[model samples]
Target: MSLRLHTLVHACAVVLAAGCLGATLWNGIAERGIALAFGVLVAVGELTRHNGPRVRQTAPLAAAGALAYALLGEAGGRPTHHDAAQIVTVVLAGSLLGSVPHVGRGPGPARDHLARRTLTVGFVAVCFQPLYARGTFDDWGGSAHALLLLALLSLSTLCDAVLAAALAHSRTGWPFPPVLRDELRALPGIGAAVVATGAVMALGVAVVGLWALPLLSVPLLLAQLSYRRYAAVRATYRQTITSLARATEIAGCTPAGHARRVAELSQSVGRDLGLTEPELTVLEYAALMHDIGQLSLVDPVPVGATAALPVPEQRRIALLGGAVVRQTGVDPRVAGIVERQADPHREQPLAARIVRVVNAYDEKSRTGGPGGPLTALEELRLGAGEYAPQVVESLARVLSRETRERDGLTRPGAG
Candidate 1:
């Protein structure tokens, strides 16, 4: 069904529950409102977090809000087998809707995490009615029901955590299930299904008290499940991207050590420029991956050719590099910057300029003997247009200080 149709059905269910349940609806509405409000708050917080730990702190709040709402209501509703059945329907409907957006998507670490989280949340929302049903009974069955509910909830959450971890792995590239992906894409409908199921549970409880709670829990749980899962998946995807970047640093003859000098120089420049942590992460990844396209260079040119390709050959090389980056399917502009690492003066942004300058320093430094390093004037002249003048000057000052401290600038043309 269309989103509008699902929404309308959900609205009708809420209205019916309110009319049928009276006082129960009054209490549950306020409680559900609080839960939803908390969900919104946590989502906003997760969006702004600077790190994983901060983002993770929001999930517990969502769980706490759910528990609080469930705990506020009293016991003694009717037998809610119908409520239990309705919850399963709502969960299945919601899962179908939530997975819709992901349909036909292929294997990817990011997509896998997203699918896993959605499935876990779907399971949790669907099992809500059973949990509440267990809550309503006063006997030993009630205890067993609560235990089962707890186990299901734990399993759902565990699945999400596992997916998050898996998505962060460098080697992972699991295909997302087409059916499940489509369900995730249609989450608004899935959310509506939860609401509808909640209304039914609320209605059952109004007629019978605590008995309807199992039904009520379904909607409450469904509303926030997707949001949390999305957050976790996003974190996982970032880690995977970082791993890919680091892999690029290690792809060539020098191993990942080739990027070490670039990173060090860039960090020095970053401190000089007062970059933030997020900016530094971006710089580090870009620097590490700057030479990635070189790995795809076929019939490998001699080492110095990076600086002296004929015009036609240069264009051909750049095109080859661009193609290799496109194969990874990351952002093209980012790929373009990496491809142009050997040509820093191509009107890049400041960070790209810094990266290119440091890259040049590392390439040149590798050629220099370990003994006394090149003279300041010699190094500056060698590195002039290829690196920023200020960066060259900074290296000059550092070298000058080191030479003075270690050897009293005794060498000819040194101080």
Candidate 2:
């Protein structure tokens, strides 16, 4: 199924390339100087692509460059003559050329990246190229023209976000709303930079010619550096929390990998419950450190099965964990969830309820035997007074889906 989807995107690009390349060839490449400039801009952008960490958009410069070409109206007091097809051809050619050096690094994901870039640039060109060529914006002054370009870029941004989110949802099987919500939330930062860069390039070039590319790129470059720093700090912070979570294991207060299992399962359950990306992060942190309080106990619970402990004891440990989390400087929200996890379901927030349900599920499942998953799920359902029914049902569905996926993979002809 994944292969088929990639094939479809590739096939669509093939059709788009064919039509655009054919038209560009027929048109004999109007404004060769301008085309060459933007092409090189995009290539340079791609050449500097960051691979350090996962991000919504890896090559903001390339995207802004391509978009600038799509929205370009005039170069140094002279208007452009290329059509939308020519714009796509130029951008695609530049991207393929730029990617050649990275080919040895396994450029498989490049296909998807190129697909997104191609579609977005082509959309803007189709909308703006013909209109600009026909004098649609000729009467509009510089201010109006800039505003128009920005508005068009905003629409293009929305379409790109939708495409990215849909592709992510298909590939990961995560719920679409939260995936899209994450994509949209990520947009206002670098996404805005890309939009602004594209618009600025187009508008500035209309007056000052190609020189604007270098002059206008400084702020965007600063923004990119700032974003990279922010990503690094976040990675470091999460690592700190993960290391903290592992302390309980180091002290022999819990089974090996118990915190990790709880974190992963709780996150999956949180996604199934339609929590946004940020909400999921808090849930994950709380789950990882949920057992940290066990370290405070003079003697750990047998096998570290807190779910099987008495409620009052569980509450005491939860409070201790929350206190530890607070002192360690993790998000206070995470601490709140940990502190509230032992509360009755009705009294707990949604994240606390989810953590409580999934933590209990993990503990019960591990001890239930070969039929552990089913038995644990049944046990969770039976303890209806303590567990949130919605969360338990959501966990059951997630487990059931995972079981099906696992079974299918183990069957013959599975990849």
Candidate 3:
């Protein structure tokens, strides 16, 4: 079957399943209608969701908000099973239909999507199961009830981080520690959103009872739109920096695409080393602009050359480049990485070490200072005291993976 037709069929199946589940859980037509309305909102949010940072996924935030509302209502002595079932149905159906646009993209992405949503709803179920048995939120005082809800939300977030990290590690073969670290770094932001939504639901229930639940969607949808706009702005900013980096090559100060190549390599190595998404982002920007100081020198270093420079000259380049970056009000972390690119490993951040190693490899490979990539890697390995061993190994692995992928693509009839 064609991909579009297949996607339609899948979406229809999901819709039917959701309808059946909702009907079974809630006998009232009005209750079923409300559940389906939330489902549609979640599906729309998923469809409109933008790609988030590497360590964080934002598409599920709206569904999470919806779930929080449902849970809060359940905590108020409403039917627990009905609430749980409604949430699962909405999340599952919304996720399936939201993914219709991406059908045929690949099995890997599809699996990741399924893994994320399944773990998400599963965690919700686990959190609510105890409340279902207890059957009353009024047994606890208001303060205790609020604290309990917060605890449940926090536990859910932790489970999400662990599961997401595991999935990422499996896919990329990255070490679990670093992957886990990345996810932990992203939790505060996502956790805040989920908690804020729960707070709103609490307020609604306090004021107007269960009927006020659906009204919570107004603010949640607005939050989603705001997040989308913020993501778009960040993307545009990245592209602008990239374009400026390329201008240096156009001016004959660097090899064509050198900045982009180093940035890409640095990101891969940084990820493997367990840098957070924000840190990786700064590393990439620093890598791209690492040679910006060369523009100020009358005798610029030759294209595809940095290792050949004297120590003092190299430090001068780093200081100057850092100053230029700082003037733009970019993150202080990015400025710090650029400034310490020439520093010893023990004195520098992991990001700095990554940029330094990848930058050296690019220069050596392009200028033929060494025999090739392998020789350059060996040279870096010999200087272990000055570089982190793990970072060097990560660079090697990245290069090897790239080579393998290139070979696979170029083989006859590969496509």
What CA root-mean-square deviation does each model show from the true structure?
18.8, 2.4, 6.2
In candidate 1, what residue range of length 10 has the lowest lDDT sum?
A: 170-179
Query: Model 3, poorest ten-residue lDDT window?
Result: 1-10
lDDT of 1 at 108: 18
Q: Per-prediction TM-score, please?
A: 0.36, 0.92, 0.77
Candidate 2 lDDT score at position 232: 88
Model 2 misplacement above 4 A: 1-11, 51-54, 101-103, 106-110, 404-415
> Which digits, one per residue and each the tens of the lDDT, describe model 3 over residues 1-415?
1333324433544554466476645653335555565566567656655554442655645546455644544424444344455566666666777767755453223455554555465456546645645765557666786777677767777876787777667545677898788777776775567666665665455456556555765666676677677778888999988886786798898988899999998988987777767777888998988888777778878774866687788888889888988887777888888888778788888888888888888887775654777788888899898668888998988778777768868999885
lDDT of 1 by residue, 148-258 (tens): 444554455445444444342212122234222323333334323432443343334435554344444545454446655775786776566556655544544234465
| Candidate with the larger TM-score of 1 and 2 | 2
Q: Over the full model, what C-alpha lDDT does candidate 2 score relative to the true structure? A: 0.87
Go through the candidates in order and give the clash count of each.
25, 0, 0
- TM-score computed on alpha carbons, candidate 1: 0.36
Worst 10 residues of 2 by lDDT: 1-10
Clashes of 1: 25
Kindly state the number of residue pairs that clash in model 3: 0
lDDT-based ranking, best first? 2, 3, 1
Residue-by-residue lDDT tens digits, candidate 2, 1-415: 3464556766787789889999988879998999999999888777767665358888888889999999988899887788899999999988887777777676623567888888888899999988887887879996888899999999999988988877766655678898888889988988999999999999899899999998887787778778888988988999999999999999888889989998988988888878988898899899999988888999888888898898999999999999999999888999999998789999999999988988888888888889888898999999999999999998888887788789878999997
